[model samples]
Target: MKTAINTAVKTRTLPLAIADFKQITKAGLAFSVVFSSIAGYLLGADQIDLTVLLLLSVGGYFMVGASNAFNQVIEKDLDALMKRTRKRPVPSGRMSVPTALTIASVFTVLGVVTLYVVNPKTAMFGAISIFMYVCMYTPLKTRTPLAVFVGAFPGAIPFMLGWVAATNDFGIEPGTLFMIQFFWQFPHFWAIGWMLDDDYKRAGFKMLPTDKKDTATIIQIIMYTFWMILASVFPVTGLTGTLTLSVPAAVIVFILGLGMLLFAFKLYNNRSNRSARQLMLASVSYITLMQIVYVVDKFL
Candidate 1:
């Protein structure tokens, strides 16, 4: 009986540890960082180095994971009140605050060190992204709606971080990548805010537009959507120096942007949960498809 009990405890504790890691790291966010890093590598590298690619991937994941872990540490109390986040490890008492902090710090140091091994610029930007995300944006979430904009700064860094990792420099290529993602976040996050406005309010998170459903908020979403579309197509115009896309690739990109715009407009007109959800889905699809298109176009 003692051995059986010990075995059961081990099994349960192991799963819980894994769960805590996932929750703290925010796996979806880590995936995005990895994808953007890969896309950046494809775009920036003249000749791909598989080894550097591997390092960038691992470093990007670690950096994003660290940011997420720190975010949870900072928001543990707020998370406990939100229905959506109540079951998270930090909020659910599955992990202690100090333990979470230690994990976050270790992951952050490891991530930065890994990136520094690739290049100093990559490491610097990675560190900056995490600092802005956890220190500036997370706290701003409760203070003002402008937190979304601040959050976008860090949110958009992963895509550009990839470029820096490949080239060891910051230039127009990374800047364009950053701009595209930077503009994309407004619509993407606002759509999410729209969908979860009620829950956000309950959790005292000012995620929506000015904490109310108003014309200004919708207009801002529309404006950002327009900018996102424009940014998405800019590379095809040969304006971003060597980052230009072929005509066919440009056309495909435009079509993708149009699809996303249509969904954004739908959300604007309806402003319902269904519309917002559709917009969120469209935004996600748009980013993923655009990344794929950019990489494929670069090769072809």
Candidate 2:
């Protein structure tokens, strides 16, 4: 009788569990990663192959989703410590470990298999991204401030992975895409760290390079934002064969960089979370617009 009841209960919870699973996966983040990958694909492809594009989207979403689900599972205890994450499915007991693990395993197989259909290189990088996110970045979050820097590697891969998917090669063109997103991660995450410093501390995650909102940390943000801006302009320099940008587009890209830098400057001058929040919003706009600019520039 007890076994039958448990099975009936699970049947009822299936839909709810799926809902919680979406939250666990952080669907918005997965979408952003997919969008970036699509931009990379469009920029690299001589002629857009809709089939490959669709496969990239499906595979990228599940791969990122699996990584995020496992991250919640690993950090379930720590997550319950902070208000920001206390209500996550794993932490709040809305979903059981077994259920979350099942989701992760399913996504792992589905994502890798779908990406494999695109190309081995795409599949390999997708799998590596999941491994690094769950195995490397997740653990380092509590131990070292440098985790942010290390996390940047996998964070930057999707943009380049798009190129690899379209071309099945890793070259200067893809490297350029990777570098832009790589440098972009620093200031973006540091700003987020600034806003969530207290919550992060409650969880023992030393996200910011420095524990405090000091001059040094702000300087690092500025320096990385500068580097990101420089990297964004690389294609327009006529150095990259596949990613060359027209002069007009280069000018527009520079302006977008300035827009992001403006907020970075505000953060530096104020040294407050309010400014950090603004910088965070600006960073999102900058990266998204920059990616759109790159794709648009290709045609003109």
Candidate 3:
């Protein structure tokens, strides 16, 4: 009986622990962030160094995980108020604040150390991304809609951090990468905010550009998306440092941008939750495919 009870207890606890880990670290989001960073690394690398790639993948995930864990700790109460976030580890009572903090602290140290091994610049940017995300963007979310703008700074760092990891330098190449991601966040997040405005309002998060699902907000989303596409193709003009895009690759990227733009226009026309969700999905596809185009163009 004792052995059977222990077995059942372990079985129950194991899945809960895994759930807690995934919630605190936001595994899917972290993986996407790491994917962009790796794409940047590949773009900048002259020769693929598996060791550096391995280190970058691990370090990037750790850094994003640490940021997310800390953000959860800070917003535990607010998270509980939102239907979407209420089931998260901290808010749902699956994990303790202290435990989450400990995990974040450890991840931060490991991430920084691992990135530092790649280069000082990479580690420095990684640290800045964490600090800005936790100390600045997290707190500003409830206070102002400008929080998205502030968050963009840290959100854009991953792609550029990879380039710095490869070249150990900050230049136009990484700058262009940073700008591309920076502009991409507005439309991507605004689409999410449009879809979840109610949930966001329940938590008092000022996510929308105009603080309402209005024409102004949709206009801003369209505007930023336009700028994001322009930034993506700027490299094709051979103006952005070592980064260059082939004409065919540029055409493919432009077509991808158009697809996203059409979705944005759909949101503007109907202003329905479904349209917003479609725009959100399109935005994700746009960024991912654009990054792939950039990296693949370089090798071919």
Candidate 4:
């Protein structure tokens, strides 16, 4: 399977390098990252500065794109072995290694500088996210099953970066935001790993906690989903500075978490890719909805 995928990638032709560059950055995925950052910022800001929010969106998106590009460049060979990634810019020869590097460098500088203008802490966190993503998470994908765990750090950063940008401090509020996202990533990534287990195996990737859709992995997913729900409700306790949810909003958050857990339980019973796919979709909805809920709760 891997050989066939590699052969296809080797012989592929490009229609346009520019289009491929977009794929290189995984722009579609970056949208969520930017949105999470914006949502975080909105939740933290007393009075929104349009300029700071705009900068955070632009800088956060580009930094995420740069990280994706670097990951593709480094994993071009391994990526070619996976059907899902075989046609990616670097693997399919649509973009050269040097070209990809140049793109990454430009995005990094622009993203970091723009974010720094918002505040030093914001830029500093941005740099740390990119570094961990490109330097740490990217390489660990094939080395150990724990890569998903490492990747969660960078993935969760956007949720708290906005608070840091607004106050120029990493306090309990941002930490609560970070903790919420940190726990949320487990079931999210595990569902994806379960759904793509075969494709990933072709590329020598082992990102799933159990590396297979087994009983133990299902149990872990359920536990993480529960933990995520618990973390999401912490704001209701008023222990986190400037982070509080009213009883009604807390109920809504609980409902969203339960919605995700229902699908997770479905995966547990079926132990199939279909179940995993549904869980993945539920996870997406949960993240987006919960953010909206949190931000809306703040205003109310």
Point to the candidate with the largest TM-score. 3
Error of 4 at 81 (Å): 0.4
Q: Which residue segments of model 4 deviate by more than 4 Å? A: 1-18
For candidate 1, what is the total of clashing residue pairs? 0
What would the TM-scores of all predictions be? 0.98, 0.94, 0.99, 0.94
Per-model CA lDDT versus the true structure: 0.89, 0.92, 0.95, 0.91
- Tens-place lDDT per residue, model 3, 18-136, is 98899899999999999999999999999989999999999999999999999999999999999999999999998999999999999999999999999999999999999999999
Estimate the lDDT of model 4: 0.91
Model 1: runs farther than 4 Å from truth?
Answer: none
Worst 10 residues of 3 by lDDT: 232-241
Between candidates 3 and 4, which one is better according to lDDT?
Answer: 3
RMSD of 2: 3.1
Stretch of 10 with least lDDT, candidate 4: 10-19
Clashing pairs in 2: none
Off by over 4 Å in 2: 1-18
Error of 1 at 29 (Å): 1.5
Native-referenced Cα lDDT, model 2:
0.92
For candidate 4, report its TM-score.
0.94
C-alpha RMSD of each candidate structure in angstroms: 1.0, 3.1, 0.6, 6.0
Tens digits of lDDT, candidate 1, 1-300: 999999999999998898779888988879887998899888999999998999899888889989988889888888888888999999999899999998899989999999999999999999999999999999999999999999999899988888888899898889999999999999999999988888898878998766886667778888898898889888877778778788888788889888988887787788788988998999899999999999998888
